[model samples]
Target: MGRKLMSTLAVLSLILQTISAMNVICYHGTWSRYRSGNGSLKISDIDASLCTHYIYAFVGLDSSTYEVVSLDSWLDISLNGFADAVALKESNSNLKVLLAIGGWNEGSAKYSTMASNSTNRATFISSVISMLQTYSFDGFDVDWEYPARRDSTNSEDKENFALLLKELREAFDTYGFILTAAVSATPSSADISYDVPSLSTYLDSINLMEYDYFGAWDDVTGHNAPLNGQSVYFGTTYAEYNLHSSVYGWIERGADPSKLALGIPLYGRTFTLSNSSSNGVGAAVSGAGPAGPYTASAGFLGIQRDFGRVR
Candidate 1:
């Protein structure tokens, strides 16, 4: 009886330890505040309990000064986006609000230039520290789309990117703050752009954006964020772009499994069907689906409307 009781206690303790280590990171897009007709989503709208870390999507770089610049002054500054987000901690003390820098279509030229030169890197590092201090942000999230890509990036960026992260990590450590990054999920892109093993050394977490595998850009329709690659069509190995494959690929490439967070899409990608009858995985697609009424893009809320119509 004593042995059975001890084993039961050990199992419960192990389960609790596992649960405590889990992190639920959520990206809160500031632009969501400007949804078409409806009033924008306020920081108060977020359920503090849902996420351990809330990242404010995108604060850009000043091309000349390398200082952080807000794309939306009203939301970021006047509205006190950082302060408001951090306010959630009043209710949930464990909640951490991080400022995410750069994003898709934000361009990589600035980042490449900043990372490549030591002077620029130092300036950028100081700017980040200053911003964090001013805004009371708990940490920083680097979202430099791609490092050594053909688009607005140079080959030297791969090495410089690692240097940038190392410096940033050092600065973050000085303040005892968190350092995280949003990285590409595509295996080829990840391999070329990042020094994954080195990145894991400095970063507290890597948000793996496994979504957007297929959308308006693709000629063929595919799952936006498939859990497994088994459903992929034959003859097309490209369908291996799924959550499982992406996470495993990063781990295999040397990213720490515990430090990697699989990013889940709050919005769904929409594709126009060329042949409604052939609406399955790998079906031909003409173009992007219609924009959402509120989001003005192919967002989940828009898809919800279609789902309602069918129901």
Candidate 2:
């Protein structure tokens, strides 16, 4: 997803490449069930061997109490979505399943409000701990969209976001719960929203959302994730928009390389070409491609291993 955020739904294919073994993290968008036919995915359909970790995308935050709550109690709680997802561990003993709180839909203003105050943060942490315990979640994920990037949030969010992670780290440690966060790929958002060094100190993994360089919203068609920047964007600030720059940008900002998880989108954002012959990168596009059959939505929809040449 872009910082503009097309949808709260993201099938994050995060590969945590460590020195010893490759750890794959997959996100199960629970709402997929609402999609018709094969678009629907339940925990039972997962191949646990393929993933080292599975994240349940989005349980929400309550405005009144600042506590985390399931967005779909009927599916997550009553239907045993939580239990079923965690049960993937049984299929692969090394697999750890966690639940994410906060998404594009959850918005930033409230999280800003919740994180800035010690009393609200405490209440939020307590509820997270309770939910983790009750649902048997191995860990928790924070996908707050952004901390200070929105107009609704203030500058204090940069510091308060780190504090929230610090507090969450302390609480999660009591049960050996792993902590992770999904963050924006572009520096436009990252620079404004994150204190990378401070938050990296608390988070076990920092998942870099490294896709969405271009989407249906664009006038030109481009790679969703290019290892190197497109020539069209060259000499522009957007020239840094690619996997190589995004990852190293974090590393340059003092994030531990080992804790960095490279995230790629498992979806595509298509465009209807104004001139099909010019359908390469930077080609002019009329508008969004076409509505997906299963997703039943208009839009939603990258590159090589050359590292140094990209910049």
Candidate 3:
């Protein structure tokens, strides 16, 4: 069964690689099931034709086994979520489904540990390939969430990360499968974590997570994802946090523009007005706004629900 699957995958991978450029990439978080309110947002709810690639957000790595693991059993196994996701290709033959691994708060420890050693890296590569084969996925999207940082990561992660990508790319090439990554937009974060030139060579695309510039964490409110850094907030310029700075920084540091995809947020970040009269772009914020009726986060859905309330 393994050999048969590999053979079938190799053929499909070739077909997918030969397709035209990807215009849009949509990330579908499986956890949206619990957050969507009514019941759960199924793979069937997606309009596959809207994007050239659809990334199913997160399949985790087992810290001990260095193998792929499901974060949600109901979504991954019970509902056969991945299979349904791949089924989207039935509607738009051009759509490619890639499984993402790692996310914010998912922790960087396992990934750092796996990348820091050759034996572990190889095991992880094999595991990822097997997981893709099992799920009938088109490719893999690595989302380590800022490697080489303190807490759950080591200083060696930057170099090891490049090596990991190199190894993964070689294996992916064998099957003609796509390879991509979701990277930090913060200039300092990007600088400390990536060897952009070497890494770019192996990635089909780098999804720049340009959102979350300012949120509940900040004492001052600002755009969640600004196209340009023209806005100044509370005497602390937000110029570095905008999309232009991120894209330009990566390109200046050796990433290719053609292979870069700027991420846009479907939701908005909300903040509690510190001074109601001072509400504007750089207003003071006490903390996060109330939760949404459905999404249950102080984001777009929440703000939408209270739009007419005039807080």
Candidate 4:
């Protein structure tokens, strides 16, 4: 086993060396937040060139990730608008418009159901692919809230999630379309139940949700994306707490970083505990911090609006 492990490490090192040449794909979160006063949104604030290879707009579907309703749920809102804006900036070239299915609030139940039945699964995939064809989406991102336990959603959903990905990969590959998934940041051997190597064989990339390391949810305070911190926290502050460490963790778990994209949140989490220290410790007052620097309290839309004005 030790000999086999070393051999695997050697191969991974080689893969790593080759992967750096691959583009560093980056994505923006929540396009609905970027609506301008005229109801027009421009993604120039994000700088299309910064996206090494592909850029994706994080779209929410019917308030759920798995329950993908109509394409209008995305096309009608700022998500599609953002895609068009980005596509226009890219000279109508492919920027890989991917609709992320499932989110923090949505669970893997929807995915499980979709994968359980063959006909329903085919219909779902067909609908999504058709949307991609109509709107020219490069691929789809499956964010199943979570697979296996240690967070929200059920552990049993892991296998079903894998099955869905397998089918998606087979279908998408035929047309040269991309298929990526947003996987959990921290996953153990059996904890994930996802065959990483098998998954790597099929999909284009696996975006590790490296953000949200810490939040206001904990009884004790911590950075959301802390490095070398006791536990996961907000803000990708330290080397150990930031995206680098998260990426390393994924690499260690057999995921190829080349096929992995880092998730950066445009929005920051705020705590309003009166007694809390400004150093990002202790408790805070009941008041909430405004989303942006100037705004009183800006949500996703408000912030995106501010960003578009600057662009």
Candidate 5:
């Protein structure tokens, strides 16, 4: 009986150790942008405990040189308060915190300019390293809106992006810090912007932005991350064409699977289709509803406003 009990304890210890050390972490945006004046952040209906790790907020990329910058003075608040709070209250010593640089609205042009010069690249890398060291950030997430081509106007910006990633990765390696980038969804976007095989070694992970599969941009309607169908081939579904599909694609192109992280959105996308009957019965949706009804705000305000508390 004693021998059997010892073996069971050993197996349980191994499982617990593996669970504690896993690196799959989820991300959230800056708190001040969505939270009330009291500086509260919550994680919606999702159980915070289930998430292996959490990336507290995105720190915007510097426009002048593509370096990371703190917006709204919330960087200090998070470092001094929130990050520490998570560690203490949760007793999660292995928790990893990342400062995400760049975002959709930030554009990739400045990254273009910064990468064009060796001197500027040096300066930009130094700034990012300093930011990480000061904040004790475990990693950095680059969210360049689009590269290798975007919306006709930014088409010329693609090739320069690969160069930027190369330089950034080399710098990150020397510092022994993890480097990651958020890639575009469509294969066209990925082909044009990322140099996957070469980039894979330099990066710790490639976080695919699997959301925004359908929205007002298109004249028709579609789900954000559907499970199957035509959109699935386009990388639209998380359960179907999601992390597994994306990581496999990268692996086929020479990327390491261990370095891949899947991006999931806590919010849902709503659309107004022209053919009501085609959309199914009672398909008329509105950003603003009738009296005493709720109103719609851009992006995922619902997640931040109501879902980011530490406890």
Candidate 6:
């Protein structure tokens, strides 16, 4: 047993600056507070200069209330996560601090219910405005995992989601709060989840989550964010699985190219190898690689951030 079988790879990604200037949207995960030592990335550690917009991720959606709420009262309120994050504005006057709601954990069902009803959507919108005002944030970002995806046969979510954004945009406009959404990179998910034209019209920017091309879910080990597919041997899915497809996938689907902010994962995907001798790209994997000292998640290590076209 001279050599270890498991391999951990950071998902490398590039922020394409197609335009002369670009929007570097930074999403700060408040939960990093739980990680002890240097692994802990407190709001105060954020360098506002490197980012154009600093977004505080993951405020919760009250399943029963359909209103915006803080998931962690201690971190967000008592520890001043939101306020301390907003205070970064003093360092960079141009940095727009935004509050984000919904993520993978919140799931699609509740959001579907909230957006399905006009009254509920209005209530959610009102809560959003109040929260933004209370925190003195410059904008709001909706990160519902997806819309319309919850019920594919019915296009209700698709249609209603558009209406929701339209009203949010109208309300945000009056308050001058920048509005944005964290959109999926998978083309199929986009096909079901987004009403692209409305997304283009209403959003100040769309955070394109372009990483996670591969993970422990697959039998073979692969890059978490490959620039392009490795080879023909890996099949067409592999060819289309890269970043190129993801960026253009959204653009081709009708999202404004200028509004798409390319997201890059700040962490890596880890895989434990079944055979130590076969530790190569298509090698067999037993399970997720050992968790990072900081993240502590078995199959995944993480952080997400993005950049967009600056007009």
Model 3 superposed RMSD (Cα)? 8.1
Q: Between prediction 4 and prediction 5, which has the larger TM-score?
A: 5
Candidate 6 Cα deviation (angstroms), residue 267 = 0.8
lDDT of 5: 0.52
Number of clashes in every candidate structure?
1, 4, 0, 25, 9, 0
- Estimated TM-score for each candidate: 0.88, 0.90, 0.88, 0.68, 0.71, 0.88
User: How do the candidates rank by lDDT, highest first?
Assistant: 2, 6, 3, 1, 5, 4
What are the per-model C-alpha RMSD values against the true structure?
10.4, 5.2, 8.1, 9.5, 11.6, 7.0
Model 4 CA deviation exceeding 4 Å by range: 1-22, 33-41, 44-46, 53-67, 71-86, 92-94, 148-155, 188-190, 230-245, 274-311
| Candidate 6: residue 157 Cα off by (Å) | 1.9
lDDT of candidate 3 over 209-277, digit per residue (tens): 766677776777787767777544444465677878888898899987788887765555678889999
lDDT of 1: 0.72
Q: Give the top-scoring candidate (TM-score).
A: 2
Worst lDDT run of 10 residues, candidate 5, spans: 8-17
TM-score of 3: 0.88
Q: Rank the candidates by TM-score, best first.
A: 2, 1, 3, 6, 5, 4
Q: Model 3 shows how many backbone clashes?
A: 0
Off by over 4 Å in 1: 1-21, 37-39, 230-232, 298-311
lDDT of 3: 0.73
**Candidate 3 segments whose C-alpha is farther than 4 A from its true place:** 1-22, 36-39, 231-236, 299-311
lDDT of each: 0.72, 0.76, 0.73, 0.50, 0.52, 0.74
